[model samples]
Target: PAASKNTIRVNSPRVRCDSASAEKKKIMCTEAEIEQKRLAALAKRRQREQEQQQQQKKR
Candidate 1:
């Protein structure tokens, strides 16, 4: 009975820890996606500005 109880206790926490990590991973994935999108937008804006400056110089 003691060994069985010990096994149950250990298994419960292991399951809980696994679920917590899974949630954390989901949040991290969303954050990474958002960062990628933001960086892409900034890069596009910078390119547009450079093109405009070149156009102005042609005049």
Candidate 2:
């Protein structure tokens, strides 16, 4: 099935690669794994915020 702009098509190469690397039919992360993931995600969000702030400053 094809996806709209907001969705990732499951069979797309990039999406398939990303999903395959990320999860192997698992739902629940272990507590440690969850915390690690949470921290990594928070770091990524902060990086994005910093980048956006820099962009806004430039504009």
Candidate 3:
């Protein structure tokens, strides 16, 4: 009975470890996507500023 209990305890933690790794992967993917969006926004802002400066020079 004690051996069966020990086996159950080990199995439970292994299952939890698998789930935790999957969750970590999901979090990493989201973080990467957020970083990409932030970079794109910065690039767009820089382009707009450059365009404004060009218009000012033309005027």
Candidate 4:
């Protein structure tokens, strides 16, 4: 029975490893979200610049 308890103790680190991987996935998801938002904002700014240039040319 003591050997079984030792085996359980040895397996504890695997649980920690699983949680660490979960944390990494969460961080990667947030980073991807941030990148998507940045790209959208950049596209919006470029569109506005193009509209302004077109208006200036019309005048």
Candidate 5:
């Protein structure tokens, strides 16, 4: 599956991880969790860009 540029995949929810950590693993996630992470990342990126623009305006 091809995710968009800003999407993050840390052990895809579709795949199972059966390493020594399987006991500590949860393969499936709620839609809310996925969307929350994506939104947080996007907000962080936007903030960084805004800060960069402000710095450029100062210079």
Candidate 6:
């Protein structure tokens, strides 16, 4: 039987180990992107707050 959309049917008689499994491995891309975004956001927040505080002091 061929691999069906609804059900997975292994054509091979011998069960093979799923080593090329991207599912088992942790995806490193999105995590790094998220960290970078978070850092940029924090820096923006700090800069805005600092500018506001300086303005308040001047006034």
lDDT of candidate 3 over 18-45, digit per residue (tens): 9999999999999999999999999999
Decide which is better by TM-score, 3 or 6: 3
- Give me the candidate number with maximum TM-score: 1
Q: Each candidate: what lDDT? A: 1.00, 0.77, 0.99, 0.98, 0.70, 0.70
Worst 10 residues of 2 by lDDT: 1-10
lDDT of each residue in 1-59, candidate 2, tens digit only = 34464355534778777797667535445666898999999999999999999999999
Q: TM-score of predicted model 3?
A: 0.71
Candidate 3, run of 10 with poorest lDDT:
9-18
Off by over 4 Å in 6: 1-26
Tens digits of per-residue lDDT for model 5, 1-59? 46653244645542445453454543334556888899999999999999999999999
Residue 8 lDDT in model 2?
Answer: 50
Query: Can you tell me which runs of candidate 2 are displaced by over 4 Å?
Result: 1-29
**Given candidate 2, what's the lDDT at residue 57?**
100
TM-score each candidate: 0.94, 0.50, 0.71, 0.79, 0.50, 0.57
Clash-forming residue pairs, model 1: none
Candidates 4 and 6, the one with greater TM-score: 4
Clashes of each: 0, 0, 0, 0, 0, 0
After the best TM-score superposition of candidate 4, give how far the Cα of residue 55 lies from its true spot, in angstroms. Answer: 1.0
Residue 30, candidate 4: C-alpha displacement in angstroms:
0.8
lDDT of 5 at 53: 100
Worst 10 residues of 6 by lDDT: 11-20
What is the Å distance of residue 59 in model 1 from its true position? 1.3
